[model samples]
Target: MEPMIWRQAEQALAGLLAARFTKDIIRKAEERMRADVHGTLPRWISAWQRLPQTGSLDLEATRQTSAVVVSNAEPIDLEPLTRLLMEFHPWRKGPFEIFGTRIDTEWRSDWKWNRMAEKLEFRGKKILDVGCGNGYYGWKMLAEGADFVLGCDPFLLYVMQFEVFRKYAPQPHRHFVLPLGDTDLPDRMQCFDLCLSMGVLYHRSGPIDHLQKMHGTLKPGGQLLLETLVIESDQPAVLVPKGRYAKMRNVWFIPSVAMLEIWLERTGFEDIRILDVSTTTEEEQRRTPWMTFESLADFLDPQDPRKTVEGYPAPRRAMLLAVARK
Candidate 1:
């Protein structure tokens, strides 16, 4: 079938990867996607392939933040569409509405967008969003007049979500969510106009490497918007959580804003400016029907909300922008 994932990612990457291991990358990605089917993934893909596309779809990625609304679809049945969407459960970072059916996600990603859009200017910029969940922010970036947005996330479900958006969206070539992580992407030294690493830094054991790689991906004088979890700490100003923070076992390092700035400077990002910092609230991340897992509410200490159930500081995130000094 001409490698479905390649067809999905090719036009978006276009010239970037055409002569540079595109075939090998596709081969590996194909292997990964088709490997050991133990759960709902196979069924999800089958259903997605068989699902009907709506007629004369009207698409909007800007009118509503974290949403690529497909409206004016009298031809598509809302219930069937909703059922198909539910197959890809746990929509984390979007509030997409297909036809009239609303998929309110776990995170009110619009809040994150609002915080970012105020500082971001994407005109004629080819941008990269690492750890981009469902490519929600990429749609917003395009809405802000970006030339193109390439999103990278290893998770297949998010890639599927992007495909869902693509089926309804015209000119989806402008935005793509590739099924690749930080290690997977080839470093095209000094290529992107801007690079964003939001909500991803702390996930890496070697956070400095993540920052350096982000810097490597940016062209000279390119901008980087880095948003990640932070902690209010004392001397060290960085916390290595014992087990879990906000019920996420994957979190490794949560640095104070000062510590993060130092890390950025060490990683060779200049003119670093802290834009925003806010503690994650229940309203921001809670169990929605779309993402049924226990969220921030279930993670925080019941008697004292500021402390996590593990008794560590609650989740707080910071947004910082810098120019790559490379």
Candidate 2:
């Protein structure tokens, strides 16, 4: 059998097995990688393989620009590179600049990052990002001085999308996106300094169990940075969607900030702090050239923007910071 395309990633992961992760953790990660059954795996791998390689590319995440920028001292052809990148279409989570080609993704994720950047500290912290779409936030965290970031999302396309950037990354091993979900993580491993669950809570059928899993992943006193869909309500309340919310079938629960805090408190997290609560606007998440599919605009009701097509409350999100109890 031919060697797997992600053999290098596995090797890089192996280097961390003894120092940072348990053997079981590494085993599960590798197993996930090896057990690829996605129909688009071959095409995504081909697109990733065809990406242009460069030497000593500069990777920068500047305050001046929202896009994760990658530039080479020597110029490269933008046309072919842009075409190659477009193979992994529906780019959902990034606004990246590779060489001179700009990939304007579906969500302006930088806006979400900026909301909480000033309040949080990432220096020297090891982070685990659940539902880390294409590892965009991982790079942003690293730029803010995170020591290491391990991202997991069950979506195979997002994992392959990360591979495209990983190819040209100056330090590829600093961040890795495994094709695993929160449920795949070993219980009570307690290895990371921080755990991030962004845009994932509502999709979970059991939100409290998801929070508890995140709490268990962190070391004693480690932090949990959670960002999820929330409704505007003063009291503890939740919206259990009858069918679909915002055109998403997996969205099971949309809780108010009060209810979210209660979930954290009940899941062994302390010092709960609400960082940011903002209404998700079309400008923040809309269709772009790189991602042409239906977006926030399509999900909202045409006559009443405040409600979804299904007559539920429109999308609102909140960022919360909490410390895992020792």
Candidate 3:
């Protein structure tokens, strides 16, 4: 073969090897996640779909009387999420443990789900956490005496992450990544007392599809816990350059609380209630935008009065929490 051709062939083989290695690593990570979760909650765990799911709560239904019911996906063994933190964040060494056994660390301090937890009564009731990132809220529900708590997300990486953390901070009856939708949920669906979804809708390609899917999962009288980012002013929602959701460009920023209320009604979620409305702090502004990697910073200092030139403006950092019943 010609030398040039041989060199090109070598380059192609190297690229293939790199891709294969990355894929294998991801696969191993997933297997590790499944193994940890199944190891901890073997009796309570079971996959609803063919895919491997993860979380700490038992998803089996237990005579739920709410409008929505929770169920488990298939069971598997996986590693603890805490171990990953230790491996990745060894620089900040400590006895690193879960902040609240009731809630995982990610959703606890900043998001303030504990405030909402005050109004919710999950004892002996079934709860479904849609888009249950790291299974934190589901852990909270289970800790609060929920009969069954299921945490569902479509992302494999998230399910894996949930499984990893679950071992160190085990909760009862929370299943993860069991892809629930209208058709699958309707079949053999159990009713639930309450359902929760947070920090999820914005990432969706079709938020309405997910909402409808959750509606099918609910029983005739179950409550839905909902939260998302919203636009406060009447002006159009802008897509920040290099924003995380900007890649998909499917994020719809509702300008008013009334708009969200109307959409819920249209989707057959009645008794719609706006639970809380709050603006982002300057620090939050910096961190969230930094997550997008959009700018250098939100401001020079967290307390800076000016929205940082390098960070997302405060107006673009609004969040909303609401609830309704089907």
Q: Report per-prediction Cα RMSD to one decimal.
A: 2.3, 2.4, 14.9
TM-score of each: 0.92, 0.93, 0.55
lDDT of 3: 0.44
Candidate 3 weakest ten by summed lDDT: 87-96
lDDT (Cα, tens digit) per residue for candidate 3, span 76-101: 32234223333322111011133211
- What order do you get sorting by lDDT, best first? 2, 1, 3
In order, the Cα lDDT scores of the candidates are 0.80, 0.84, 0.44
Question: lDDT score of model 1?
Answer: 0.80
List the candidate 2 regions with Cα displacement exceeding 4 Å: 1-22, 34-36, 55-57, 61-64
The candidate with the higher lDDT, 1 or 2, is 2
Candidate 2 colliding pairs, count: 0
Clash number for every model? 0, 0, 38
Worst 10 residues of 1 by lDDT: 55-64
The TM-score of predicted model 3 comes to 0.55
Q: Best candidate per lDDT, number?
A: 2
Predicted candidate 2 versus true structure: per-residue lDDT over 253-287, tens digit per residue: 89999999999999999999999999999999999
